[model samples]
Target chain A: MRGFPSDEELMKRCKSGDLSAFELLVLRYKDEVMNFIYHVIGDYHRAEDLCQETFIKVFENAGNYRPRERFRSWLFTIAVNLCRNELRYRARHKAASLEDLLQADPLSERFLIDRADTPDMICEKKEREEIVRRAIESLPESQRMALVLREYDSLRYDEIASALGCSVSAVKSLIHRARQNLRKVLLKAGLGEGYNAGI
Target chain B: MPGYRLKCEEVREELSAYLDGEVPIWKRGLIRWHLMRCRDCAAEAFELRMVSRALRAWGDVTAPRSVVENVMRAVRLRRRKMEEERARLIARILRIAAPVAAGVIALLWITLLPAFYLSYERGKVRPLRDELVTVRVIPQSELEQLVEGRMF
Candidate 1:
């Protein structure tokens, strides 16, 4: 009805009882949404569940979708809200350590190894990466969220602000502070100078 | 004015933004003037630049393929189950409403019409019964005898 129906078109059909359209929407966004959630929650299993739940909400609430907003942004809004809820729940329950967050899966190990420039480099890089990741994980929730959205997702400052419901300046400050903290951690690990040289 | 002296602490504070190229032009000039004279500030800026470079390199690190696949699979299953639930709910509501509408229509046709007809028939039968009772109470012969006595 309105300019051919991008995702909104499919979603409008979905609201009018088009099951196939809804399925198509799900197929299109599932991976992107899953990846975002995985990085946000820092746990594969939980992120998996949250990703499923996100789609379920999208499907059930399809009727509530307004054409004025980008479908992806709205969908991600639902996801970011869910992630915030999950993070809050985790905090209430007790914080999960970096060791707990790291996947012991052989696949992860293999993935790291494959990316290595050499066998010795792989081990050294892996150790450094682990330390850096831990430093990131140790960041305050807001800073971690800001860095992840910007660094991993490549979201712009405004998008990060929108996702986190903060001011643009606040997002910038968060990322800057996160980078500073990471630098400190790497410096302490004796990898800072080496990492700098390699970079 | 005395020659400007840029403190190491002040230069270090601006070094992060300098490395990011976010330093304003005026600040950049001041930082350059300071760096030209201050080795410590110069070294600090270099170190900050290196740190940024390392972080940029860290971006190359990626999650495993299997992890990605596993997450995708889980997401797919979740969506499928939700779609099924939505369909089931719509079907259930339709099922309930369809029978309710049919039952209302059948009740009007099979029960309401007959009951209305029977009520009309009772109305006619009541008037007839009153007429029959009046006739039985006063016969034609009694009426004729009253007229003949009057005449005599």
Candidate 2:
């Protein structure tokens, strides 16, 4: 078995001014962190930028780290905070509307609909995907983060709470409320007992 | 939706916990029992679960390689900048402190040189004064007669 330094070990080294440890951390978490931010902002470019920013923060704040805590949770906490800041900026600046999300990464849009799909099938899938995306976009920021961290990232409730800067019960409540809202929207979009219908 | 003494609201509130497999065993049993009987709560739980499942179906994307490279480059630049800043601060402190230290030494020399000189002169004169006293060996009455103008 190959031996690897734990994140806490690397973080300790980083706190002592080791840039290599910081780089190692960035390399380790860039993908998942980027993906998390991508789910949040729905823009690959912005998500990638936030990933850089997140590491920069980790690098700068390494000195403040407590070795006893989980490093990944701390990393995601930073990432989540940066994502929230970006969201706040967007809201404050009246920047890109939710419609921008569909085309944020054009490749992803096509990835969902097969080339072999009939026009009607493609249209239906596109519509459903669009509704789902909009429903997600419509979610309150906190709820959206909770749902994203839970559903896509598969983080535990406690980890999600840590990342969200909320309590476990709050995390649960956020997910519950988010699901309730999504259910209402999806059902109103004419999904019935057929919600189990495969996408 | 509370009625007939059934905790429908409470069940709805915790259905998420139940779905997440986080509910305690007793509560899990209670929720399961409630879910078994109430059609409305059951449908609601089912729908929420489906929504959660649909969300999981959202695909994951890989971070671009450039992100890692750019972050590493930026971090290195920041580290260099920090080191340079620290060096500059030290140099600035030295620049300010060196002259202050020199001024303090010069001031101390100026203030205490006379005292040092007087102490040195006193050291030289003290032995000669002692030798004179020993050579004379005059008694107090004799010194008094000399001071009274009597010839020695």
Candidate 3:
């Protein structure tokens, strides 16, 4: 049975100046790309801007898109590279950290926890979420990227490897190291003993 | 390292892949068996799972409407600007080329075309016998007398 046009086909049309095809590609992957940037950067507004930049870059480089490559990984590679540059720029400037970035923005309360939980539970959940975010931010860049692609995006190990420009075994090791480091951070926060019981 | 400790290290490295189901069947079984017998490995596996769950707790987010609108707007502006730049380039080239083209045509009219016509008429209309008959050389005395009359 005929299904929808694939991403490569849309990309080919985009190369031929089809705006609608480009728009469809944007709509199809924008959210996921935004979420990825948000998780990696720990800031919503920056993620939104970077998401737009990512798509614009894709459009600009449409003529260079190779059909043999997987489009999703190619897209993620662009997003990841942008995230890397943003992080490096922040670091070079000695800018505010993730916590500061979050606290400074008054309208930055987008994370939705369980509604049934009491206020205390909600606060703990928020704290736990913050810890997770900081741990992820503390990881080495490649490790954090590999872990996020694996845990958040659920990309296959091979796909993550492709996006990171590494082998599958390297991806696995990066994820393992990321998790072990997170476990250390969780343990330090006193949440290691029964963290798995229920969050 | 001790034999069992060495075994534990290898299993620890593979635990992430094992949890991800990326390991082969037989290897997965070996890791499973190792985890079953080894308390430390089991705890490590459990911690990794918890970490994965914690990361997933962030949940899915929908891209805001502004993102799409802003992207399309930016793209349209860029494309329009590119087309304008292209038009400006062509106009610039023509601005320089038009006068040069007209000058080349004028140069050909002043030089090569008349020369070509004279050469063609000489070859086609003037015979060698007629050229010999019309060869009346003017005497130097008459030329000088004509110059003196004009001067006077």
Global lDDT of each candidate: 0.70, 0.83, 0.85
- Give the winner by lDDT: 2 or 3: 3
Residue B55, model 3: lDDT of 69
Model 3, range A30-81, lDDT digits (tens) per residue? 9889888888887888889999999999999988889999999999989999
Our tally of clashes for model 3 stands at: 0
Error of 3 at B46 (Å): 2.0
Winner on lDDT (1 vs 2) = 2
**In order, what DockQ does each candidate have?**
0.10, 0.34, 0.38
Q: Which ten residues in a row have the lowest lDDT in candidate 3 chain B?
A: B1-10
Residue clash pairs of candidate 3: none
Docking category for candidate 1? Answer: incorrect
What is candidate 1's lDDT per residue for A156-194, written digit by digit as tens? Answer: 676677777888767767777777787787688786778
Question: How many clashes does each candidate structure show, in the order listed?
Answer: 0, 0, 0
- The sequence of per-residue lDDT tens digits that candidate 2 reaches over residues A152-175 is 777889999888888999999998
Candidate whose TM-score is highest: 3
